[model samples]
Target: MTPFRLGVLVNPLAGLGGSVALKGSDDVAEQALALGAEPKAQQRMLQALSLCRPHFNNIEFKTASGSMGADLLEQLGVTAQVLHQLEPEAVTTADDTTAAAAALLDSGVDLLLFAGGDGTARDICSLLEARGRSDRQVVLGVPAGVKIHSGVYGITPKASGEVVALMAQGELVSSMMAEVRDIDEVAFRQGQVRAKHYGEMRIPEALKFVQAVKMGGQEIKELVLDDICAEFIERMDSDCQYIMGSGSTVAAVMAELGFDNTLLGVDLIDCDGVIASDLTASQLLEQIDHRPTKLVVTLIGGQGHLFGRGNQQLSPQLLRHLGADNIIILATKSKLEALEGRPMISDTGDPELDVALAGWYPIITGYHDEVLYPLQ
Candidate 1:
């Protein structure tokens, strides 16, 4: 079997500055003191290394220096083949990120896996777009920042580890969305919550999903869409597994099914009930294949992304398990109106897969009320 090339990038300063900023302490030491964060970027990198290292005996982990990208790989008992970075004074910003990522993409790696927040993801995504390398090749994200907009992440660092473990096995995964919860930092500092769209990234959306947090000043009803989704899920065949997607809408399926859900996170469900706690693509597929199954999902409130936003746990293998026909979308009239002609955005970064999901899909609003909305 041909070996797959994996690229690793670490923004040692990813959450470093977030601690001082009102965005919450993205800095590990400061976040550890604040008790909200676990100083996770480094730990997450080590975890990904542990998972990826054992699988790729002939593989090389190329990175940048000084915890910027390649340095962290060295700490993980891995060696960096090339050095690409600038002075520390010039390294604090994400500007070096795009150039460094471009360098890796040029190396012809099969995949690139990096650890950082949404800012890092946007830089990489933009770089990939600029280089026209965002197609075919895949990228995975290790959660390490205050906010992650790239749909290419799992619900947690460990879950990200699990994804790399399976992907290294050369398994197929589904494209997912990465949503960086938009927040008005200036207004937030003034004691107001103003959250809006930051950007989107494409990753593998897993059954165990991360729910998009309702940004500041938003009074979103967690139940409106639930009421609608539950009505439809109740009609599903209990013998068939139901691969539920992320969002409060799909959470209603769990509520109606008599199971607990992580309101703003993703969960897996089927005839047996909740399959697992936040599954990546590979995990979901290992459970859903060969069994009659369907997927129940919903669109993002304002952005209206049906797939690949805030749902990185999904892998390509999972999407094939349920097939597109088995997928269900639940949305409220208000949520639909919020889109206002903006096409349902998908940044799973797979152009062919993105086009495959394009078409008019059936959206169930409430019991007995449904509409065919275009996913394009």
Candidate 2:
């Protein structure tokens, strides 16, 4: 079989803002660096390169120079044709990303493997559209950014590698147009999520590896939320501490109990009222220490993600402590149908925890109604 030319690019500073609670690293890379944040995109790209190293002979890698892409591939002992020459600096900008993408496109690569979040995706998407190469070339994203609402990204770095391997072997993988969504960093930092579709790209589809585009909660019904709220109240156990997950759907449940809720942050509640609002990961663990606690959450509409998207406050450690059985999932029928029979996903960065959280879980649809949905 003929070797497939793969273009590799890393944003270098992608996901630098997540650990420091910066929401996104779009224009705040310097702040994240000042806060002692480390570069994760290169490490994640290394993970992908490591997984695909065995098939190196079947793939010809085309990458940017320095910390952008070729450096990581070189560490893995894979020789790649360096396309763009980036200046040696402590930081790289959006221009570097666009230039690398343009050079990769000009090199006639079959697939472009990128490491970053929505902003990086937007940069590449714009380059593809401007060059009119979106239809001819396939793109895949390694999930290394903070705000990744794009459907072009794989669920994880390892998943991205596996999909690339499949394509390199000329496997019968499908392709489709996925949305590239980005949010305002300023608004996102203030805990207000304002995501917009920047563009779309044709990406290789791997059912278990690629992620779905996040859906907006614009089609919400007040009555359905009211019914779900009433249902949850009826089943509340006064003795068990209930931790409310983030999202408008979970916020609705809190509204029914006549308590002020954190619309986009984690809150802990009980039969009495709200115990804590806008708690952190450490605070969540402290509040639920050695006590019988349950978590209430809802799925992202089109994405079908149960965790690791907007609510990173629900740490993997916390999820392991709470266990899957003690968790309650709420979603409207319209939201569930939006998935078109796709299982919900979780990328908590813990493979063991992700596996444990997998399988079918009962999702409360409305008053006295439930459906078994697979959590993958």
Candidate 3:
């Protein structure tokens, strides 16, 4: 039997700004480094590959040289054929990514698995689209970027591996065309997000494993928020700390209460008013320590992700502390219908927690309207 041909690529600088609150890691790699931002793409890619190790004997891995691809696989005891070589002491760039993707395209690989964010997705998709081969190849992404607005990536690294394993086993892994979205990083860092579709690529259809393209939060109806805010305000506890997640829907709740809110950052609120603005994971933990806390979050429009998209401040540990009962989900009826019956999802980066959050939950859609939706 012929081994499954898989191409691996990694953007080593991806996700360098996530923990440091840079919003994105596009051109500010230096600043992120100055702020002690470390490499995350490699570690995340390793997690995906480690999960795929069970099928190592049945797959042939092809990748770029050194840190871009081959080194990490080698570290995992999996040999990968190197197709492109980087100059000594040279930093990899978009050029390197396209060159490697082109080589893999010609190598007749079954799938192209990349580790990076939306920019990396655009690179590969642009290269393939230029060659008119974008529709012919199957691609999957390991989420390792600060901004992952693209639909090509899996919800998490381990989920990416699950898709690979299914494909390798000759199982029924369907394929579909998904958008490769990108955002203006400059505007993003400045607390503005401008997401646009670069192009579409062939992605494996594993709804549970692959994430949908991020929907703009501004699409929600303002009137619906009024209702949600009323309901939320009525239930507010004077002593409980409210960790509000990022999104316009949640922002409405803040505005309704006359509290200033960061449109794209996590905030903390209490009965008094805004406690802290645009907080980090550490800051949130510090404020919520030994106190009753409720996480108020709104889902991304079309993606249906409850966590692990842009709101990394609500880390796995934070969600675990808040628990399921204390989570308040707010969304418009349009947003829920946009999913077309798909379940709400959370890739908190903790598989166990993800499972715990996979059951059904009631979503606050309006003032007196609540609907139970499956969260997977």
**Candidate 2: lDDT of 92?**
95
Q: Which stretches of candidate 3 lie over 4 Å from their true place?
A: 207-376
Task: After superposing candidate 1 on the true structure, give the runs of residues whose Cα lies further than 4 Å from its correct spot.
Answer: 17-21, 24-40, 88-91, 133-136, 177-181, 205-376
Per lDDT, the best of the predicted structures is: 2
Q: lDDT of each structure? A: 0.62, 0.83, 0.81
Could you tell which candidate, 1 or 3, scores higher by TM-score? 3
Candidate 2 residues lying further than 4 Å off, grouped into runs, are 207-376
State the lDDT at 225 in candidate 2: 76
Ranking by lDDT: 2, 3, 1
lDDT of 1 by residue, 1-376 (tens): 2334567777665665455554633224344446553345777778766766667664556666666666566666666666476676553456667767777766655457788876677678777666554533467788887765446676777787777665455333334344545344456557777665545544543332122333323354554555576568667787776667777767766777788786655566666677776766667767775577777778888877777777766655566445556777787756665676444565566766665665434466555444434565
Which is superior by lDDT, 1 or 2? 2
TM-score result, candidate 1? 0.48
Q: Return the candidate ranking by TM-score, descending.
A: 2, 3, 1
